[model samples]
Target: MRVIKVVFLFLLIIGVLVLSFLRPDDYLWLSFILALFSIVFLLIRFERRKMEARELVLLAILASIAAVGRIPFASIPSVQPTTFVIMMSGYVFGAESGFIIGSVAALASNMILGQGPWTLWQMVAWGLVGYSAGLMQKTKLMNTTWGRIIFGIIWGFLFGWIMNIWGLFAFTQGGNAVNMKSLLTYFAGSALFDSMHALSNVFFLIVFGNNWLKILTRFKRKYGLLE
Candidate 1:
């Protein structure tokens, strides 16, 4: 059921993009409206309604870090600190917070580079990464540093696949089939970079996640959040 929802949501976004291409003057507004509503609805449904001021501030900081990490955008596949930070934040915070942070990071970063549909796709991709990271909370695996390292590898592959899909959309504009060569190149380049990013995330998690969790727990206790 969850998978179905994800598929439908993805297709809906693709449909909106197609509509934008066919009639940018008329459908662009429609696309924007749909995207806005979708994001709002998702945030409300999947996340806590009354997030604390401190959490919001942390989210903003994570987004800013992500944005800044994307400097020198033309470098193809490189080590992206934003991905690690956002994923870790989401794992520690919550899925909703993670999604917001990742999306904001992508959107803000692209503003510095330039704006386009690519930005939107990247935002969606990173947001999903954070969202999925949150699901790890359900499993007891997320409680341990080794578990996070394993999850980070999985996260890296997942991010690489999503980014490759986004690259196909951006490069081919959905006109041609994503050929093997392109797929291979994307995986070889992006997977390598993402794996490194994931390893870095593992290191960060080992070094900082427990301490951050302790701090957030204290804050939560003070505010009576999640008991």
Candidate 2:
């Protein structure tokens, strides 16, 4: 199952890379279709593993917390606690669990907030944040205070950049594909939102990161879940 997840993950990256370069103008729906399939496939693989009841329960709790956590921040533009919570989940649990939690959080939150083509991109971006945070746990990046701080800051911008792909695709105003000028202008306009995202990440990660990790780690250890 791990092998399958890794293999599919590799393929997913390659798919993104290919479409990024090729970007067949008329074939945009294909990206969403592929993403939907990939997400579904990942979930199926997760389920097929005969996930423990406790693990499922834990995933649910985390996803719900991440989702509901975003609601109160709606008035603050891009500032939100969702990424902070999801990133911690990934950091302690490992990549697959992080991705699942991140993706589910996006989906669940949008149910209250509203959904659109953008939701899928958010699911992917947030999932990647958690997924990468989990992967970083094995590296020196997660070892020190500054390193983790840097991680949160970087993903703040990265999460915005990921969503920008959808913006470019959808808001190009019939340009059909992104051009250098439109892309630059769109990104420039979004800079404030992205900056807000990155700064908010640093704030939450710096202030609440350690405690959240300790609490989550304690729960994991007590339950012997995600082992």
Using lDDT, give the best candidate's number: 2
TM-score of every candidate: 0.72, 0.83
User: Candidates' lDDT values, in order?
Assistant: 0.65, 0.79
Runs off by more than 4 Å, candidate 2: 1-4, 10-50, 174-177
**Clash pairs detected, candidate 2:** none
Give lDDT tens digits, candidate 1, residues 93-149: 667566667777777787677766556556667777777776676677877777877
Residues 53-102 of candidate 2: C-alpha lDDT, one tens digit per residue: 78878888998999999999988989999999989998998887788788
Q: State in Å the error of residue 116, model 1.
A: 3.6
Candidate 2 has what TM-score? Answer: 0.83
Which lDDT value does model 1 have at 214? Answer: 77
